[model samples]
Target: MKKVCLLLLSVLVFPLVSSAQENTEPIVLLISLDGFRYDYVARFQPENLSRFIATGVAAKSMMPSFPSKTFPNHYTIATGMKPEHHGLVDNSFYDPEKDQTYGIGKKELVQDGTWYGGTPLWVLAEQNNIKAASYFFVGSEADVQGIRPSYYYAYDGGVSNLTRVTEVFKWLELPQAERPRMITLYFSDMDDVGHRYGPNNEEQLSAALERLDRELGALFEGLKSIDMTINVIVVSDHGMADIPVDNFLNLNELTRNIPGRVVNNGALAHVYLENEKDKKKVIKALEKSAMPIHVTDVDHKENYQDLMYKDRIGDILIIPDRGYYLAWGSALPRIRQNAESLGTEVLGEHGFSPAYKDMHAIFYANGPAFKTGLEIETFQNIHVYPLICKILGLPIPEDIDGKLEVLEPILK
Candidate 1:
């Protein structure tokens, strides 16, 4: 009886002890340079980020999730789930069941927590008595899992990158008990420039690289001044590809014979039908269309490499060839208007299949825990969340799609 009682008690006690251990003490800093392609370090020679790569354990490239766009991949990095698993299936998408729309450009929709399904890192951190902070991450300001970080700054694009770096340093300067253990910083200049001027435009890309290098230089010095000893992990959501001015394939014109709409995100477009009955007509129209683009019906599952949620996409998915994008209807979203404009002539875009080299992202980590001067080959971005948890000494949550063992090779 005594042995049985002790065994029963152990079952109850062990879980609480384990749960408490999730509040780790180690500090971690995550920095995201949006649209910083894997090759940018070698191609543009950004001195500061390159120096971090040389001394740190870095990966050759990080393959982004399908629909390799900004919001999906960034949310994937935070939640450790593919966009399908996280319910952020696209940069902007409508849920058939929920009849709800989600997009990064919509501030009110972004703040609403109902759209987010998976538990993000910051929310998980707070559950374990750990204080976390974020400068301007996608889910930072949201009431995700009904919890925000101990410190968060509302996203303001007008704010300078230098200020974002200084803000992280300021957070670190707080009293140990009052400070956050995990923090995220972001910069979008690289993504902005890469899109405004085609990635192939070496002259403009060179100027953007100089600006990125200066920020990295400043961030490192600020951390040094604050005496914050922690792991610094840098990554880009996805890379960019060149989409020339003349490459616009107007889906409306080609599919004019069919009755449907194309919800486009510059690089990828999803077709929706006025009625389910029109699916056949839409597919037939696309099949015979003259546009040089890839088309797949969600019902015909065999052809797709990774279309996690078929219902989320339209009846006929339109994937424009490289150097091209889809345009539809009378008016387009303002975000894509400049890219489609003649005078703007913005050339770089990325929503290509993840298999394409142009969609690969950057990953680098430097800290006491990582092996120095180490370079790992290409890996999926999903594995990133587990590595961040390992650096913080926190347990990877059970529901996360990532595996801690996947990153064990580089850990000391």
Candidate 2:
């Protein structure tokens, strides 16, 4: 009877064990070129990347989620969920429940697992007994859902692009049993330059594109030398918009009558009121402004219904039209006696409504599992997480807003 029971157990487990051994799925490389505008490839003439797009599937552009900030969008791609659904609504938001602020530079808050909702790609990979590594991708360093990628580096901007690629190649060289089949890398030079100088600055933007192209060339050559067949997904969180810094609506001046404050200053101005009854007064003040912007309340944002956590943001949302961004209240009066001392131009900014053309991001993929010469139309950035999960053969969590069917048009 013992022999019979043992035999039965073996029969039940044999297929799973063998399937795991024979799983020769194509290795996946997830990379993000921060603020890589879809037009940058053609605009800057990035030869290597341009050639790469020709050999694989390319999305005309990717529409980011509302607020369109970096942290929110990056987390969106990783979790296959919208920013509100994933609990990262914006780059800078105050969570009244936790009394915690999510900022770009706060390493501790970023590492805090409680702030993140849903399973990031790294954590998902770990759940499937898959080893993964991330170099500087947001949320990779955090312990999400009580698990992290088997091999993830701390998020650090000082790491150069060339070094990042070199490290990936080295990881790929490891023994099959020990190597991480999934990898994520990030490059922030483009975004950095876009923020420092407007996207329209031909000289600086061109230089940033060329530098990225050269680094990508080196990465491709290194992968070839190792003779590894890899599926590479290149994406960007969001694009840059030219904000005429000289012409920003001062929120303080506009909302003087209302007992509220402008909480955030950027493409979107978050307004919080001292009382619920003051909502009407605030809306009236913004409408009175001559600037070309659309102000929405918590009830009527562009995709307000789609957000699972709509209340995370302000009651009064300020979404500026293209070529405009908001300014902080203390910029002129508090800093200097004269408001005239305020700076003139803000080069570039994002976090505007995702509907703008400038906020459109880039998505290009080429590998064994993807069809060549396929160009997909613009889709929501949330849809990208499902594609990564499919390529890695990892289970897509049912709770995510990103659907695997959305990627059918691009799949081989």
lDDT of 2 by residue, 1-412 (tens): 3343234334433333333333355688988999887788878878778878898999999999877888889999999888889888887776667755567778888888888898998888888877888887878888888787877788878887766776776666566777787899999989988876768888878987877787786665445434455888899999998765565667566556767555566777667666878888778878878877777898665767776666567778877667766666667344233222434254667887777888889999987788999888999988888888888888889999888898866777
lDDT of 2: 0.77
Error of 1 at 137 (Å): 1.2
Model 2 residue 41 distance off true place after TM-score fit, in angstroms: 0.8
Clashing pairs in 1: none
What shift in Å separates residue 195 of candidate 2 from its native position after superposition? 1.9
TM-score for all models, in order of appearance: 0.87, 0.86
The C-alpha local distance difference test score for the whole of candidate 1 amounts to: 0.77
Model 1: per-residue Cα lDDT over 57-89, one tens digit each: 889899999888988898899999888778777
Scanning candidate 2 in windows of ten residues, the lowest lDDT window is 335-344
lDDT of each: 0.77, 0.77
Q: How far is candidate 1 from the true structure (C-alpha RMSD, Å)?
A: 11.3
